[model samples]
Target: MSQWFQYDRRIFKYFNYLLVIQIIPLLAISSYLINEINPLLFKKQMLYYGIGAIAFLVTTFIPWRKLIWWFAPLFYTMNLLLLLAVDLVGKTILGAQRWIEIPGTGLTMQPSEFVKVSVIMMLAYLISKKPPLEQGYGLVGFIKLSLVILIPFLLIAKEPDLGTALVLLITGYGILFVIGINWKIWLVLAVAVGLSAPVLFSHLHDYQKKRITDFLGQPSYPVHQALIAIGSGGVEGKDKDEATQTQLKFLPISSIDFIFAYLGERLGFHGMVTVIILYILLILHLFYIAIRN
Candidate 1:
């Protein structure tokens, strides 16, 4: 019992309470906005928060430094296997086969989401084992790391989840960039991607291509409604019942993807600015923590 207390003290000694504080407001706002839209979803969101809190507490007790060497690779492989399983027996929703349904439960899980964290941990573990040199990683080292990212990118893209795949690809490469990469390799990559752009575009699903075209041409229906919601909010926003855009269901998925639109409608320009500022501060604080560590 005493040893446990000492371990807890040691963990708390370096805990970044400010980071938790920053996140609380965002979570609270999200819950409030979601509740306003759908009570059922709000309840599920709260349940998720509870589960996350439990996960956080459990992770606090883990000796990550000791276990990460093996655990990171194991976790990455498991997630990859799950991604592969999605192709075999995955559930489809909204035209994307990115979920695996749990047996005897009406709940589905997305391996792609878990893969994001695993990939980061795997990269960290690998990088710690073999760091870059003064001029950065050479061609051989670069290809090895690139494969770690590309394999998952291909799998997720095959699921037709291009957005998430691109995000993972960018994030993985961005981390490598920060760690250091040979300039020649980057130049070659740039040229290669440019040359492959046409082939990549051709391979995109029709809806995905249409989405790109819509972005370049004009705003889609949802985007248009989101804009209207923001514009209507003006400087001071409206009351809960008065935010007609979201209240009347004009803004699609107002509680989920378009929550920001609802926020704008409810709080107006000042509210939006405040949320943006908070997010900026949180991001800057994260960077500070990363650099310090």
Candidate 2:
């Protein structure tokens, strides 16, 4: 018991408390949004939280660094295989075939999500063992690194989940950028990306192009409605009965994507400021941990 207590204390001492602190507001906001939508969903969300908490504890207790080094490639390969399997034996929903249904079970999962973590683990394993030179990673090293990132990026992109693929691509490169890369390499890459932007844009799926065009042209359906909700929020917010935009469901899926606007409509500018402040604090805290660690 004493040994377990000591272990728990050490974990707590190093754990990112500030990041954990934000969970309170996150849960509160999520609960509020779901509660307003469907009371039963709030109950289901709590159950999900219970399962997620256990998963968090399990991952937190694992000695991830050594495991990441030894198993990253194997884990990443498995993730890629699962991604490939999606096309062969995957389930399709919402017009995109991104999910794989587990055999003999009702559960389904998106492999692309898992791929993100594995990519990071693989990158950390590679770069930590082979630190970038002062001039940064040479062409040979760059190709090796790029191969690690691009394989998953291409696979996910082929899944027709460009949003997630771009996120993975950006995040992988962002990690590289933060860990330090040659300025010359970054400059050339940036120029190449800039030159290739149109070509890349042309190859995008029609829906993807539409989304981009809409963003560049005018705020689309949800954005327009969310903006209305925000504008109506003003300084002080409205009551549940008075918040017509959200209450009447003018802003659909507000709980997921436009929660900020719904929050603005409900609690007004002050609530928005508070959430923004919490996020800013969390980011700063993360940077502090990064530098300190």
Candidate 3:
């Protein structure tokens, strides 16, 4: 018991309190927004918050650095198998077949979400084993790294969860960009992507293609409504009675993807700026910590 207590104390001694402090304001604002929009969802969000806190605490107890080399590959393989299982027996939610339902619990888990963590761990493990040279990774190294990212990218994109898949793809490359990849390799990849754009577009689902078309041309239905919500708010914003776009359900999917529109309508330009600044600060802080460590 004394040894366990010492271990806990040692972990706490190096805990990053500043990171936790920065996250609190964001969580507080989200809770307030959810509470105002729907009291029931707010209650559920609180429960999720509790689960997240416990998860964070549990993760802190893990000896990550010590075990990462051996554990990462096993973890990554397990997640990949789970991703494959989704194709055979995944649950469909709102047109996307991206979740696996747990037996008898009426609960579904999204393997793509877990894939993000495993990918990062696998990347860390691989990179640590064969770090970049001063000129950065050569063709062989780059291909190995790209395969780590692209395998999962293809799987998730096959799920037609393009948004999440693209985010993962971008983030994976972004890490490579920071860690160092050969500049010639990047130029070649860019040219290759440009040449293949049409082929890629041809493979996308109709709705996904429509989204691209709408984005490049006119705004889509939900987007147009979101614009109205924002425009109606002006510079100062509107009262609860006046914010009819969200209040009267004109703003489509206001609780999820379009919550930013709801935020703009509720608090206008200044609020948007404030939230953006907070996000910038959080991102910059993270970058600083990553570079420092």
All models: lDDT? 0.90, 0.84, 0.87
Off by over 4 Å in 1: 1-8
Tens digits of per-residue lDDT for model 2, 198-291 = 9999999998998999989988888899999988998888887888998888997776678888888888998888888887877887888888
lDDT of 1 by residue, 68-156 (tens): 87899999999999999999999998789999998985667889999999999989888999999999999998988888899999999
Which candidate has the highest TM-score of all? 1
**Compared with the true structure, what per-residue lDDT tens digits does model 3 show for residues 1-293?**
43322235566798778888888988887777767777777886787679888987776666666668789999999999998999999999888899998798555679999999888889989999999999999999998998999999999999979999998999899989988999999999999999999998898899999999999999998999999998888888888678899888888768778888888898899877888899999999998988899
Q: Score every model by TM-score.
A: 0.92, 0.86, 0.88
Task: Quote the positional error of residue 134 for candidate 1 in Å.
Answer: 1.9
Worst 10 residues of 2 by lDDT: 1-10
Predicted structure 3, TM vs. truth: 0.88
Rank order (by lDDT, best first): 1, 3, 2
Clashes of each: 0, 0, 0
Which pairs of residues clash in candidate 2, taking residues 3 or more apart in a chain or in different chains?
A: none
lDDT of 1: 0.90
Winning candidate number (lDDT): 1
